[model samples]
Target: MSGAARQSVSSALPRSVDVAKVAGVSQKTVSRVLNDEPYVSDEVRRRVLEAAEQLGYRLNSAARALASGRTRSIGVVTLGTALFGPASLLMGVERAVRDTGYALRVVNTMEGDTAGIAGAVESLLEQGVDGIVISEPIDEGEVPVRVDVPVLVIGAPAPFAAPHVVTAGVGAGVLASAATDHLLDLGHHTVHHLAGPQRWYAARDRLAGWRTALAARGRPQPPVVEGDWSAASGYSAGRDLAANPALTAVFAANDDMAIGLIRALTEAGRRVPDEVSVVGFDDVPVAAYITPPLTTVRQPFDAVAREGLEMLVHAIEHPLAQPSPAIDPPVELIVRASTSPPPGKPREPSGSTTSYQA
Candidate 1:
């Protein structure tokens, strides 16, 4: 048969036997290359890999798992919302998992109680996930869960004994403090906060940060406007904030709320950064293009995911003591048009022409 005919006639579902034949090596050698076992000579390893690639061979995950007693799959648990923070964090995590050569499985749960979270974990475990990552952990308001497999909890600390990886970049406390301090530094006498749900660790930490900033500077605390991390809730909170003439600065837990708050403030005839300065968190992509580009705190979701996945893999492999990994990524502040000194204070540049008031 012609070489082309031979290639075409080859089994589409290529196996280690086919790779061995093509590479002039034993099936054992091909298995070693697939498993990345040491002591395989470089030339032989290269030949085996080339043959595998040429034949479109894929290692059977189930067979490999059976042999090694590990599924070679990573699982993730997250809220079912399309919220930018969780969504972005998940993207980063998936990338990291793919890079680490593991199949990714995900389970989404409703944000009601710890039972939902527990259920998701159980589902992943049943599927035989070698490791698991919880992207957004709530207080869950239940007893801690015990996970036998290596686990990593993002955003909030792990409820049970496992490695907790804080998304590097911005912490709730850090962002809230920075946002409040920025407004105060710009001459806003006091700052009001539109807080996210108290059940969320992010929300509680942000609220604490705002309170800390205010108390440290001896500024009186205004009644907080509660929000569900939604634009609608922020709008509702903003209306309340707008009615109070004493309020000149506001810190929102996230950009979505900030956008809604800005809309409400504008409708109420309160000029943002002129009559009121607003700062938000997450620095969502559209934040810079909003009516008045939002001055916000940025979270490095991609970096956090990469770092987190690394930590998880390390835990899975080592299962013992090793050098500690950095838990949080450095937070960043993006100065934009939405923030400035309150009206009549020394006019600080907002760096953008989009007027929050206009």
Candidate 2:
């Protein structure tokens, strides 16, 4: 048949059968190539892909799921907020999923909904997702008795025996300690804290890390001012912190709060680093652009997502095999201009004594 005649007969949305015919291969071979099944020769796989591309053929995911009993898709559930942590984690997961040739589905949940986590899971399952990922689980008090599929939780531990992954928040204790120690090493008498809401696991972990570092150095732990992970909250906390002349350094739970705190302190006639050094968690995108670019802890979100995808993929591929244990990625502290030695103090020499008096 002539090429024009064949084109006229082809469906606008080409199918596997059309690709097989064009490539002069069996429909099963087309399936194997589409699904990345092993044993197909390189030449055959290349021919199949080229044919599919030329014919504008797209794999029918639903039909493939029916035949293989797997959807080749993963679902993610996260809070319905524009918070930096959850949003960045989601983006990272998406990049990893696409790289692995899997489809993604995401669901966002609100607080205080009676149908919270359970409802989100049901919706994903109904859509035939092979596995589910809870990106950030708040303390909702609802644990699944048993999910028939693999599940991975980020930030908080899974309520059941499912696998989990840790973002920066998991190691917040150590991260906070490191940030505090940096300020202390700069000759600050004592570092104050601007904490996130107490209800959040991230906030709590960060607070604990800060406390642990302070206690280790015999420095007094100041009262924690709570913020709602908003710049406004940080500003309010900053105001309270600025009033206290004793506070020479501040560690905010996240960058937003840090920004607010800095603004408030600046308005109060206090110079950052010169008067009060500030450090924040979550090296957000805008951290460097702001004046005196924020010195903060950078979460390895890409690493966390890549790890979570690896675990979930393993569980999906081997339902009966045991999944790997949760792993915590290492976090980095980016020292910027926002922090420095307190006024009237020179840089401390190695093994020098740290004076607690302001």
Candidate 3:
């Protein structure tokens, strides 16, 4: 075939019959050549090969997978709530699966309990998913080891007991540390932390990072104020933080809490970044538009999800591969308008002092 004619043929034909027509051979001969079925004569095989090359015909992966007894579908289980991190992670998984020409069956678990997660997995299995990716954190003692298919868990590293949990690496810790350091860099003597519930891996890692950053600077780790990953709890925590005139900078574990903290501080006549600085994690969509845009850390959700899915697919394909415990993606710091140095000094206690407002 002439170069120009071959290019035109390649652009126009994508099926075996089209290649057969171009090569002037039977479709059966083209199929034999494609499958390496040995019955074709040499001349016929050469014609089929030239035609296939010219036509740029490639075998369909779906047909191949079906014949191989492998379903090209993956199951993804995640929280139903539209929280920033989980929602973003799900999107990333969908994007990666689509890029690989695989289908995804998403199951949203309303809660993070073992029963709920297991049920979601079961539903996905009923749909014939080749592998599963669980987007919820594995509670301390709740890893599932008996599922028949390969599963990838996408939270903090579960204990050695859990078989194939892949976590977004030091990203969470890096985020927490970056927020703390930002506060410190702004001349805050110490950064107080408002942590999330201990049951969550993110909560624990963030607290550890905050403590480590503070300790490295020889600053005292303030008593932790725990919240339930809710804005209400953050608001209540903020009330107590507002009482101490010396409490200059605060690092809330998530952006919701940071939003509440800012509101509480404003109500108490404390000016953000003037009287005190505030730093938060997650860099949620609304973080930048709040009263004073929040200074926070951004998680690499796309990279994390892509890695988690790839790991699960690998595990599903090769059941005997040695298990790796965790995977962590990197994090970046985002500087906004809400964080700055502390005010002059601690104000003298007086009738103005208020106890926990909640």
Candidate 4:
């Protein structure tokens, strides 16, 4: 037969029958192969594949899902802000779902309200999602009262009371300690902190880490300035740091704040790295493009998202398995041009005593 004639015949045939006929097997065998059921021989699998290609047969995902009684869909709940970190995490979750041949159903909270979160969760459940991934970072006290399905909470530590929840393994303490250690290693006597909102777990844990590192090094803990994870708040905190000439190093909780601090320092005629060194967290996209390029801590958003989804799926498949929540992931410091030895100050001998300098 001519190629064009063959094409027309192939196009006219039904997918299931085409697969069966090409493989010289029954339609039941084709269905078994598609479903990955046990008892299918390797030779039969190869024949099925060749048949599928020859007949232009594509497995009907909907039909397959119906047979399995699963929608093969994952529900994602998030604050829905376009902030770099949250947005990147959402993309990562979507990527993981697609790669797993599952559909994604995203539900965004309205202004991070608890009611909004509860509603979003309900909606996902109503849609018959097989699992849920909560992308927002909430305090342990603020977690939803009850979720009927398996859930994975990203950003915050997993709630111990909730066995089904999994958190992004990255702990704020690790990020904070890494930043503090970097500044300390650069010969700064101590590192000051510009913190995020007190209610946030990240802010709390990071502050704790900073203090822990300072204590371990026997360095005095400086006063902390609180910001709301905004550039403006950072600018305000930066102004204070600029006035205190004794302040040599700083670690801002997030990159946005770091940018603001840098701007404030510049306006005050203090040269970054020369007069004051800065470190930040999140290592957002713009961190590298900033005037001096920020030294920062990098969060593994993609890995967190993938792990969270996988955990949720596992919980869905075996609701009684109840795995222990993982500890926060480790954070690494990325040293860059923004940090260096403090200017205009000579290092004192290790055991030397000096009069008050500030």
Candidate 5:
């Protein structure tokens, strides 16, 4: 056949019979190999897979589901917001799911969605999925869902009462505490918190971390300034905070707010690390490139997703197995030019701190 004719024939959907013809195997054997069923020798399996690849033989999901009673899919419940933290974690989950060779079904919900997480779970359950990941960081205030299958709740507490549900994404407390400690170690009296909206469990966790760190050092806790995780909100908070001479250090919940706080501080003639210092969470892509180079703690989004999804998949494959112990990802505090000893205090020796000073 001419190249055009060959391409035209290949363009049509190839069936299992085509794979069987190319593999020189019986259709039964082809089916077994494609489905990853046992009893197929390695050599035959390779041949069948190679032929399927060459023919672009895509398995029909509906047929596969009927045969195995499994959709081999995972549903993710996440907030509809495009905020950096949740969005980045969701992207990490997407990458991890693809690596697991499972189809992804994401259902986005708003904060006030009447149906809530239960509704999102129901929608995915109707379509049939082997697992589910609830990446919603916001606490929906007791919106319950009937979670029968394995569920992985990342970056938030598992809201489901299901026995198969597991949680991932360690609290931001450790990272937040490290951030506060960094500022205190720089000779700041106490660290102020520019908290994200308290409705988000992440924000609350970081807030608690800040308090924990300060309390451990016997430093007095400062009143917290709340922001909506937006630069504008941070700017507004900064403008008000700029009037306080005691505002020497701040740990903003995320990078965008930190950037805004820095801008407001600079405009008010408070030089970063000289008059005031700022630390942020999430270590956004532009954190280092910002005017003063934000000192922040990095959230291991990919690592969390990979570890969490691996645990979820394990539960899906072996429901009776003892669950893998939760592994807390290392907290990395990236010290930058935005932090230093207070103006009148002596700076630490060169290369003195053990933290990852980026």
Candidate 6:
């Protein structure tokens, strides 16, 4: 308990310094206890709570803004769709911001709105936010965003550049390479790809990763089957792929598409992991329960959020400090029944493929 490390580090509200003094703890400790962040012991938490209550140290975003040049609130511009990747990344941001004692202001952008992100940023600036998070942005050629505040662009390329703009990635290409290599290591001749739409940076990264893995192994690359990140599109792609007698493995962009592909393959008389092996990205909750549980790459949503926010808040607080070098989020590929060696070939536990090329 006491040995546990603080998962997130954030600045303390100015008024919180008094509570820290009264509780005989550092400002960071006070912030942790107040924000319900983990790692503090029960005794320290109780003491901090008691001191805060006695001093009436309530959180006031406006007061914090006046005192620290920060609203203590963050604005996020994200896609409004209920798709798994965007929704999950948004949820991770919500948790990370709250852990840092920061209030959240959100602006949802429709999928095809030309001015969505630019307009959303303007709206958030009208209110007031210390920093901004641009999550899962699609490739819109050129974006007209020129904000002065520190910006954290996650899982996508930065739309605009500025001294304070910080870009962090989800390592989607690396994760996709892992999924593709899993199939290649399973003794498949060549792994086929079920790609997401090219407009999305995430999908493009995954597609690039798949290509990298194939190239690394000197394997023949098949034409990609593009999906709209939906089950229907995957089903259609699956029907197309099932027609090829040499198809033995498929790497899907996400779990939804993977599931639909499985259905199509099943109906087409090709059994999963027997006639054809499948690997997916995003490792959704139901992936394990599905028939022939899916083998997939699990994205580190929480890790990426926490790491990106940490750098952003640092940039916001110390405008003159050198930007911290970003470390890639940890990537993990969950192995399951859907992937195995080619039919009549023995399975090997060692996926001793060389490191990811991209």
Indicate whether candidate 2 or candidate 6 has the larger lDDT. 6
C-alpha TM-scores of all predictions: 0.75, 0.74, 0.71, 0.72, 0.78, 0.78
Q: Per-residue lDDT of 25-53 in model 3, one digit per residue for the tens?
A: 88888878888899788998898888887
Q: Which runs in model 2 stand beyond 4 Å of their true positions?
A: 1-67, 144-146, 160-170, 324-328, 347-358
Predicted candidate 1 versus true structure: per-residue lDDT over 278-344, tens digit per residue: 9999888899899889999876678667877777777666655452446555557788988888777
In candidate 1, which residue ranges exceed 4 Å CA deviation? 1-69, 143-146, 161-170, 352-358
Model 6 weakest 10-residue run by lDDT: 1-10
Q: Which pairs of residues collide in candidate 6?
A: none
What's model 6's overall lDDT? 0.81
What is the lDDT for 261 in model 4?
A: 99
- Provide the lowest-lDDT 10-residue window in model 3: 1-10
Cα lDDT tens digits, model 4, 1-358, are 0000000001133467778988999999998997788899999988998888776454544335546688878888887677666788789889877877778999987554777876786677667777677776656355443344456666664432333555454566766887798778768999999998887666887898899889999999988999989999999899889999798899999999999999999999988878899998888878888978888888767766666666667666776665535434445567777888777565322211112110
Of the pair 1 and 6, which is ahead by TM-score?
6
Instruction: Report the C-alpha lDDT of model 6 over 163-237, residue by residue, as the tens digit.
Output: 476767778888998888888877899999999998998899899999999999999999998999888998999
Q: What does candidate 5's lDDT look like per residue over 1-358, in tens digits? A: 0000000001235678889999999999999997789999999999999999887565544445756677889999999998988898999999999999999999999886747677888788767788889888887766645555678887676675554777776558778888899888888999899999998989988998899999999999989999999999999999999999878899999999999999999999989878898898988889888887878888878878888888888888887785677666667877777887877997654222234322
Model 4 C-alpha lDDT versus the unseen true structure = 0.73
Deviation of model 2 at 223, angstroms? 0.7
Worst 10 residues of 4 by lDDT: 1-10
lDDT of 1: 0.77
* 1-358: candidate 2 lDDT, tens digit per residue: 0000000111134668999999999999999999899999999999999999897565544444667678788888888888998788889989988887779999888865636767787677667777788765467665553344567676675644433222222356677888898898887778888988877777887888899888888998888888999999999888888889888999999999999999999999999868898999988999988987888987767876787687778767865566566555555778888887988987433222222211
